[model samples]
Every structure is written in structure tokens, then in C-alpha cells.
Target: MKVFTYSEARQKLSTVLDLARSEEVIIKRRGGEVFKVMFKKATPSSPFDVPGVKTNATTKDILDAVHDSRARKLGI
Candidate 1:
């Protein structure tokens, strides 16, 4: 962990960011306000990142069922 004053952090923003990636970087203000900088891990993007549905219905089966229900409701 490292500590830097607000002005020091502002002057060495790049170094502070690099240090933050590996460890904690704290910045203190003249008025006694303190802040910590840390890196956030990003989630990997996926096409199949959907909620789970417990059903055995296929896509075509679902479409056919919808069409049948609509036709029956319309009496056609």
C-alpha cells in the first residue's frame, strides 16, 4: 500500500494508476478527505450470457406452439 497527497497524485497520475493496478494507492486531501484507488477486473463478453430457463422446448417447437395457440384463440 502507498499513500500520496492530492497534489502528488495529480502530478504523477500515470505512476499512480500503474501502482493502483498492483496494490492500493491512497490519496489524502488537505482537508482530511481520503480516497483509495484500485483496479476493477472486467468481465469477459459472451454471446450466451443469458438467464437460465428450465425448459426442454426447442426454438422451432416454441414458435409452432405460439402459432397454434394464436390460431386457436382466433378460432382460425
Candidate 2:
């Protein structure tokens, strides 16, 4: 863990963040306030990736339903 005064942290903000990646970082204020820095790693995923809904419909059934809907919409 590393502790730095507010002024020191401001001067070495980059270093403070780098150290926070692997450990804890604390910043102290003259008025007796303290703050902790944490690095939150985000997980990578595709925007199209999502949980699927369980249904009894098959691929062919879904296609047929779409075609029927379009045909009605176009007055075909």
C-alpha cells in the first residue's frame, strides 16, 4: 500500500495510478480527509453477446412467422 499527501498525489498522479493497478493507494488532505484509489478492470465482450430467451420456437418457425407478418404488412 502507498500513501501520499494531496499535493504529492497531484504532482505524481500518473505514478499514483500506476501503483494503484497492483496495490492500494491512499491520499490524505490537510483537513484530515482521506481517499482510496482502486483500479477496476473491465471484462471484454461483444455488443451482440447477450443471454438467450428459452422458447419452443424453431428457426424455420421464426422465419415463417416473419414472412407471414411482412406479407400481411405489404398486403400481399
Candidate 3:
């Protein structure tokens, strides 16, 4: 990830876009605080593979698993 100031991104919009299409770039303010701009690799199934998400478990499934685990641990 690369951080670029607002002015730099504004002046080099084309280059920024090109870089963003290939890699992640962070656009920030003068104070070094980032407000916007996130980049990701180009892919077709990008939406399917998400981090920290369990596609196989629903709310009820999670509750059931928790209940089972708790019962086993507590002997209840």
C-alpha cells in the first residue's frame, strides 16, 4: 500500500488511477490522515472471497454451535 497526498493524487490523476488498477493506493490529506480511496486487484470472483466471513454458517447455525460448545464445556 502506498500513501499519496491529495494534491499529488490530483496532479497525477492518470498515474494514480493506473496504479490503483494494479495495486492499493491511499489518498490522504496534508496532515497525513486518510479520508478515502481503497484499491483491490482486478478479479471476477472478488465478491465471493471475503475475509472473516463464514459462508457455510447462518445465524441459527452459529447459535447452535455456541450452545453445543457451551453445553459440552459446562456439562449442562
Candidate 4:
């Protein structure tokens, strides 16, 4: 764990944050108040990142299915 006073933390804010990514960081106030900092994992942006079902399908099979669905026919 790393500890820094308010003045020190303010002076090296970037360094403090980089250290916080790996371990705990503490910031102390003159009045004896303390604060903790830690890294938070980022969330995925893609909706397809969700869990998938087991499948025996190949890439060609999947693309062929998509192509068939999009094909035009005279009789609808």
C-alpha cells in the first residue's frame, strides 16, 4: 500500500492513480481523514460479449445461413 498526504497526492495525482491500479493507495487529510483508491474493471461495450451456447456450426455455415435469409425470391 502507498500513502500520501493531501498536498503530495495533489502534486503527483497521475503517479498516485497509476500506483492505485496495481495496489491500494491512501490519501490523508490534515484533519486525519483517510481515503482509499483502487482500480475498477471496465465493462464490455459490445452486446455480443454475453455468454454463448455450445455450437457445432462453422463460419461458412453461419454466413451461408445469413446469405440464404437475405436472398430475394419472386414468390416472397
| Model 3 regions lying over 4 Å from their true place | 39-76
RMSD in angstroms, candidate 1?
8.3
User: Could you give the candidate ranking by TM-score, starting with the highest?
Assistant: 4, 2, 1, 3
Task: Return the top candidate by TM-score.
Answer: 4
Model 3 agreement with the true structure over 1-76: per-residue lDDT tens digits? 6678899999998888888776788898877688555565556577777657548888999899999999999999
Candidate 1 per-residue lDDT, tens place, 1-73, comes to: 9999999999999999999999999999999999999988766578777668899999999999999999999
TM-score of each: 0.56, 0.57, 0.43, 0.59
Task: Report every candidate's CA lDDT.
Answer: 0.95, 0.96, 0.80, 0.91
> Can you list the residue pairs that collide in candidate 1?
none
Off by over 4 Å in 1: 44-76
* Candidate 4 structure quality by residue, lDDT tens digits, 15-39: 9999999999999999999999888
Clashing pairs in 2: none
The TM-score of candidate 3 is: 0.43
Candidate 1's TM-score reads: 0.56
- The candidate scoring highest on lDDT is 2
